[model samples]
Target: MKVILTETIESLGIIGSEVKVADGYARNYLLPQKKAVLASQANRNMLKQEKARFELQIAKEKAFAQEMAARLEGTSCTIAAKVSDETRLYGSVTERDILNALAEKGIEIEKHMLLLSEPIKNTGTYNIPVRVYADVEPEIIVEVVAE
Candidate 1:
């Protein structure tokens, strides 16, 4: 099905771009979520008229993401946990732990934005990427120490 995207979808296309997608996906997810609309002549013309506003909004969002990336650069957080052994922790350091540590440091971010593939199970320093926006990921130092 052909539809006009109203938001930037990483797997799909950017805002205002008309692209073809699966019928069920378009009907169930995209349309219901208001992320896209049917690509008709009237809708296309309406999107064209709103293109300038969308561009401006996209620019502002990118700028904000860049600003957040700058702030996150060289940022580091230390989490102290109970160690069962010299190098291993009793429990792994999860996203929530990292979030709390960041919060204590006055840096706030969503859990989904923290690109941790797995929990930290060892006591050491690790680099964790924080996805502030599209293609704007900044690595922060996470040092897990034995308490």
Candidate 2:
């Protein structure tokens, strides 16, 4: 089904773009979440009028994400955990552990924004990327140390 997107969906299209998606996906998720609307002449015209507003909002959001990226560029977190004889962590350091460490440093971010592909299971320094925006990703140094 063709739908007009109201937000930027990575898998889909950007704001105000018309695209065809599965019927069930459009009905169950997009419409219910207010992320898209039915593609119609009226909706098209309305979206055309609101396109400027959406662009401005997107610009502001990008700017904020850029600013946050700058702040996070020099930021690093140290996580202490119990280790075995081989210097391997008894328990892996997950995203929550990193989030808590950042919170302690007065930096707050959504869980989904932190792009941790897997848990840290060793004692070493690693760089993790934080997805601040569609095009803005900043890396933070994470040092996992033995306790």
Best by TM-score: 2
Q: Candidate 1 lDDT, tens digit per residue, 84-125?
A: 989999989999999999999999999989999999999999
RMSD of candidate 1 to true structure, Å: 2.0
* CA deviation > 4 Å runs, candidate 1: 9-13, 19-25
The 10-residue segment of model 2 with minimum total lDDT is 8-17
Clashing pairs in 2: none
lDDT of 2 by residue, 21-132 (tens): 9999999999999999999999999998998998997888888989999999969999999999666999999999999999999999988988999999999999999988
Could you give the C-alpha RMSD of every candidate to the true structure, in order shown? 2.0, 1.8
User: Which candidate ranks first by lDDT, i.e. highest?
Assistant: 1
Candidate 2 at residue 28, lDDT?
Answer: 99
Q: Cα lDDT for residue 5, model 2?
A: 95
Clashing residue pair totals per candidate (backbone < 3 A): 0, 0
